[model samples]
Target: MPIFGGSSDSEDERTIHHTPKLFTRQQSIHSLFGGGKFADILLWREPKIASTLVIGVSLLWFLMEVVEYNFITLVCHASMTSMLLFFIWSTASDFLNWERPIIPEVVLDESSFKHLARSFHARFNQILSKLLDIACGRDPPLFFLTTISLYILSIIGTCFNFVNLLFIGFVSLLTLPVMYELYEDDVDTVAGKLMRKMRKLYRKVDSNVLSKIPRGTVKSKKHT
Candidate 1:
């Protein structure tokens, strides 16, 4: 069975649409991640599956972080445990004249893999293109925001390594979305107020500092 379940909606239909808001612009939290089965999982629309996912992640964190098991060690231990059980079952069934256990065949589907590869390729390229645009000064606000975000991440990286950071992010994904969805109105109101304050600050800075800077005029070149 697939770990992450599939959605009924096609890939194109997975992209969600949202009304424009003062703070979020063209997207809300639900729509930002793409609204479908995946969004439902993130938002806890299916509480049982969401809870299972949370529990599983918590167990993995405990095993890796707390128990300090390396990836290879953990995989080996799990495989040994599984094989031992299967061995016991097979022997016991033969002795007891019981039906033999049937092991399910696991196969990788080519088409599904190709589809996933294509999706990843497209998304990766899109992100690279957008980052290039921001770097080239095509979007000043986005460029600044990206710079600040990376700086914050770098600071955070000093405290937690990549694995710990990934764990934290995974836990947050299983939490923050549902919480925001439950309290959407209140959260949006607070966000709007915060954005207004930010805008006011920006305007003050523009007038007091940026506007005072001298600008050189661009001269038109005459064609020879």
Candidate 2:
């Protein structure tokens, strides 16, 4: 299924006349990676980065296995301790003129503050509405499939390591959007043809077996 759900009127077009019919390898790589034609594809591909990151971290796990090193606990303690001390180090001279303060200065006037708050509230509502649509509505062709896929992923999350899930999602995020964008125009015709074939197959199946099946599921219960 295409990663991004929710379709528009423009998506129904058989062909994107502006897009070139022929696709080259470099163009494909560049589209996904955001690189020059000559740039190394491995540098931009998320799977490669995620895999390498895991392999590198596996060395620490290997150390723990062989040498009885407390690398995992040490990492947690060291990171938290370092961050705490580092923040204290920011307690310095001048009018709180620390070079890298975590918080930004609040310089807004009352009107500007109200405007910013209103803007954020409006944006949040828009996002919430879109999320509701994606969760419940099947207006988009991929909506039901995407929803089921995510539900399955959540169910399986407990079986895998956090890093594994992170990498999986990281790769999906990096590749899916660009791949769909680059090939969407070409895919329309293929999707249409495939749908036609599927409909034909379904008609035969329906006539033979599905039509005879009871419609018990379709019946709604009334609240007393």
The superposed Cα distance between candidate 2 and the true structure at residue 12, in angstroms, equals 12
Question: What lDDT tens digits, residue by residue, belong to model 2 across residues 1-224?
Answer: 22322133354233233322222122554443434321233333455754565566566545555555675776887689988876676766234775755655878589866765776687588656656765664333334445667789889898766655665665565555556656766664465544434444655766898799987767688999
Model 2 lowest lDDT segment of ten: 17-26
TM-score of 1: 0.74
Each candidate's TM vs. the true structure? 0.74, 0.37
Tens-digit lDDT track for model 1 on 1-224? 11011212342133222212433245667675556567889988889999999898888888999999998999899999999999999999989988888998999889877876776687688678768876996434445556888999899989997778988899898888788778876666564444344445655776899899999999999999
How many residue pairs clash in all the candidates, one count each? 0, 0
List lDDT for all candidates, in order: 0.69, 0.53
Residue pairs of candidate 2 with colliding backbone atoms? none
- The lDDT of model 1 is 0.69
